[model samples]
Target chain A: MQSLIVDLGERSYPIYIGQNILCEALIKPFIKGNQVMVVTNDTIAPLYLDHLLAHLSGLSVDVTVLPDGESYKDLTHLNLIFDNLLKNKHNRTTTLIALGGGVVGDMTGFAAASYQRGVDFIQIPTTVLSQVDSSVGGKTGVNHPLGKNMIGAFYQPQLVVADISVFATLPDRELSAGIAEVIKYGLIYDYSFFCWLEENIERLVARDADILMQAIHRSCEIKAEVVAQDEKEAGIRAWLNLGHTFGHAIETHQGYGNWLHGEAVAAGTMMALSLSVQMGWISIEDMDRVRRLFEKANLPVTPPKNMSSNDFIDLMSVDKKVLNGQLRLVLLKTLGEAVVTADYSKEKLMDVLSA
Target chain B: MQSLIVDLGERSYPIYIGQNILCEALIKPFIKGNQVMVVTNDTIAPLYLDHLLAHLSGLSVDVTVLPDGESYKDLTHLNLIFDNLLKNKHNRTTTLIALGGGVVGDMTGFAAASYQRGVDFIQIPTTVLSQVDSSVGGKTGVNHPLGKNMIGAFYQPQLVVADISVFATLPDRELSAGIAEVIKYGLIYDYSFFCWLEENIERLVARDADILMQAIHRSCEIKAEVVAQDEKEAGIRAWLNLGHTFGHAIETHQGYGNWLHGEAVAAGTMMALSLSVQMGWISIEDMDRVRRLFEKANLPVTPPKNMSSNDFIDLMSVDKKVLNGQLRLVLLKTLGEAVVTADYSKEKLMDVLSA
Candidate 1:
């Protein structure tokens, strides 16, 4: 097992990675009290909720399996968890275990943050996407009608348990979804990791343990180093959102659940690369490479057919990166290197966007 | 104006106390952004919202007055603020001004904290209760069905504008409610302040600005000291909740909005004193003095009718203060000092609890 610390001082926590870390004794020390609430979703509920439940057995535990979708990640669903915790008499000391992918982790982290003005929560991320991305960052919230993650807190979890074994049962579509985000780590900040993912795409799809584990670990190392430096996403951290501004617009425009988040982000990354080329920061050859690498992973490379270009731009204006009036984009200047800037003009953006 | 700084580093804020600060240029320099949302209630909206709106006419602003009452201090109310903010296309940089009592301040502050992962907010407290307590602590949240202030954060405002002139039109019952929290400042951590309140209780009720402002400044100083030591309520901060444990039970049991929160706290403070004497922490003469003070302020001194002892105890269990299995209580050792301990026999607690 490999233990990585987030280094947030008093709020700092650990992310344990390995095949059997879930059953390992390292985590029991952080469990704060007797009551525990396991928050997962229907898609992930039938698979590994029982494995987590068996481990939580002599301790008082309650499990809530919400409907599986991004649309459900709103006030109604958050309230369901709140209702269960309160009805079951969970207190501030009660620990919450988020036992699924990004949606489950985000919602659970937020519910934990808001429940009783905050409580302790451990992340038991079951999907590759969560293991590599969402579990590492302290960002937590659901999408709103006006924007995605427009309401949330920068609340860190006490522990993140990335159990690789749980990903074995992910559906082809979901597994592919996780691969998109995995490729994102390479595309934005590491040309070498990009080259590595380019070479190992098939093995990862085949679920080769060594390659998959390395991808998870390296991605986490890169992310943890970035997050440790900028916990509040004030400056350098915004670079991590390479495809998210476009990703959020696509997801909101596509009506949340119609496309998985990472799938939208996959297509969004293509758009970001295209814009990077239009802005003269990167070569067209590099954009083609990003598209080809995504294709090899079976990821979507085009925007969803339903959303209007006008609507997409409007949605992007509300992105967290758009702090002032202008929208900021995290674009790639080269493989393994990214830049956060809003210097592109309307004409250039619209020309590239019309594609 | 009484300038008290609640120091929490980056989250630190200043609470300003005086009459006509809102209409004067005194509060203008602290106002940061152009876009502002004024959150108020029907009772306070009619009384003070116009004055606030008039003062804010030079800036880009909107006013939303929610249904009047403590019951309105919930997620639904918070959602209303979000809905309006989003509908107005107010970006994360917009400032939110809470222009009522504790209910308005709490919900607006929380809305600021969670809306787009936080925005700037200023406290324009119109009520005497808010000017002294809620405005300074940086504690913001709505009530849950299970308990009060159970879901909140320690989010500070940029500046607090307390206009004493707004209190001239305040109702007698509401004015008395404010006195209850005023008396609390003396009870928990300041015996001299307690003695002072005892001597000048009638003067404070008569709207003596010198005494009222003194009471506000001293209360803020004691609260500021406790919050500075433990901003997150990990220890010392909970002492500020001396009467709130039982106070919340009374508010929750009486069907919220039935009795003013300060009035409920007034009665609960007496109960805490009665138990303190029973536990040999204070003299019987102290309880007598507390009773006399509440009477002079025209505040309730008994648990409201129809609330059972069992209901109060059950309610306290879900409080943010009860860590693990212990029901932590902050009791006065003397008028000027307090102690927090869970060391009490169930039988002993039952005697005072069952009354």
Candidate 2:
């Protein structure tokens, strides 16, 4: 087992990565109270809820299974979790365990954050996208009809248990989607890691457990460091959303769950690279390498064909990155570096869109 | 003008209490962004929205008026604020100003807490209940159908401006409701303040600016100290909910807004005192004195005659104060001191309910 700590002072918790460690003893210490509620979606509840129940068997555990999809990540579904909690009479001491992918993790984390003003919860992220990114950062929320992740909280979890064995059951496309975030670490901060990803792309796609473990571990380490410095995203944390600005536009336009979050991010990263190349900040060869790496991982390499430049601008305008009505984009300075600023010209942005 | 600071380290904010001090100069320093969205209810928007707009004339300000009453403090109303924000393309830099009473303040605070994961907001509480209690501490959220304040966050405000002049427009019942919180500070922590209230109840009832200012200032001070010690209600802060357990049941049973929050709290405090008397923790005379003080302030002294004991027990059982499935009550130790415990006898509790 590999372990890492998100050093957020008192709000910090440990992340444990391994295969088949979802047994009771490993999860017992993190259960702060006797009342435990497990929040998962229908897709995952059938696959792993029983395994989780085996660990929580001796204690009082209730389960709330929401419909499985990004589309289901809204206030209506969020209320189901709260309804279950209220019905079961869960208290402040109750511990909520999010036992699915990013959607489940986001819902449970938020429910825990607001339930009784806040409660402790554990993340058992089953998807690579969640294990590597969303689960580690304490970023939990639902999407609004107008935008993605528009409603949520930065509530950290007591523990995140990422069992690598679950990847064997992940659909091929979902596995590929998760790799987009894994690739994000390289494009934004680690040049050598970007190179490493280029070399190891085939092994990751083949579900090679050793290579997959390496990817999840490295992604979490990068994320933990960024979150520690700016947990609230006041400064450098914005860099973590490099592909998110355009990606959220795609998600919002295409409607959530129609396109996977990581898939949209993959395409959005490509657009960001095109803008970077237009600015002469990164060479076309580097941009190609980035695109080829994503292509190798089976991720999308362009924005959806139907989305117009005006649509992108309109959708992106509502982004949280908008500061004083100016859209701030996170662009690559080089293969392993990125910068968040509103300095790019409209002409350059238009060129990338027109292309 | 009188000012007191809630010393919560990085989250600290000031509470300014005075008459007709809602001018631009007093509020401008706290506006972090050029875009300001003031969230007010229908009743208050017609009354004070223009006055607030006058102070914010130069900035890009948007006004969202929600329906008035506690029943409107739900997710649907909260989404109205979000819709206005997204429609106006308000960014993370935009500041939300909650410009009504407790319902508006609570909804706006929760919206700011969750919008874009988090944003800065200032409180311009127009009611004594909000100025004295909800606005000072960071306990911001909306209610769920199952329970009051069941869904929310502990998000603080940037500043709190309590213009005492607004009290002149307050209905007699609302003014009396506000005094319930004023009396709470004394009942929970300060004996001398309780005696002071006994002496000046008539002046406060008449909305004497000088006496009302004194009451609001002291309440903020006592609340700030308790909150600074335990911002998240891990310990001593629970004492602040002396009458809230029974009170929340009333709110939940009667439906939110049927009985005002302060009114429910006033009657609930009497129940807690009755329990204290049964426990031999306080004399019957002290309980009667407490009841008389609330009556003097025109606050409720007894639980609504229609609510059954079983309903109260069932409702209170789901309170946030319940731990390990046991209900914890905040009971008076003597006159001013209070203790939160589950150690009371079941028979004695039954006796109080039966009586």
Model 2: runs farther than 4 Å from truth?
A: none
lDDT (tens digit, per residue) of candidate 1 on B1-355? 6787888888888877876767636556666666788888888887777777777767878888899788888887788888888777777778898988889999999888888888888898878889888988788998878778766676889988877888888888988998888788788788889889988988999999988888888888888888899987888787777788888889889888998989988888888888888888889987898898999999999997787889988888877777776888878788767778888656877887888
Give the chain A TM-score for each candidate.
Answer: 0.97, 0.99
| Candidate 1 displacement at residue B132 in angstroms | 1.2
Candidate 1 global TM-score:
0.97
Superposed by TM-score, candidate 2 places the C-alpha of residue A101 at a distance from the truth, in angstroms, of: 1.2
Look at candidate 2 and tell me the lDDT of residue A115. Answer: 90
Off by over 4 Å in 1: B23-33
Report the lDDT tens digits of candidate 2 across residue range A71-181. Answer: 999988999999999998999999999998999999999999989789999999999999998899899998888888888999999999999998878998999999999
Candidate 1 residue pairs in clash (backbone atoms < 3 Å): A189-A336, A190-A336, A191-A336, B191-B335, B191-B336
Cα RMSD of all models vs. native, in order, equals 1.6, 1.0
**Local lDDT at B306 for model 2:** 92
The numbered model that scores best in DockQ is 2
For model 1 chain B, where is the 10-residue window of minimal lDDT? B24-33
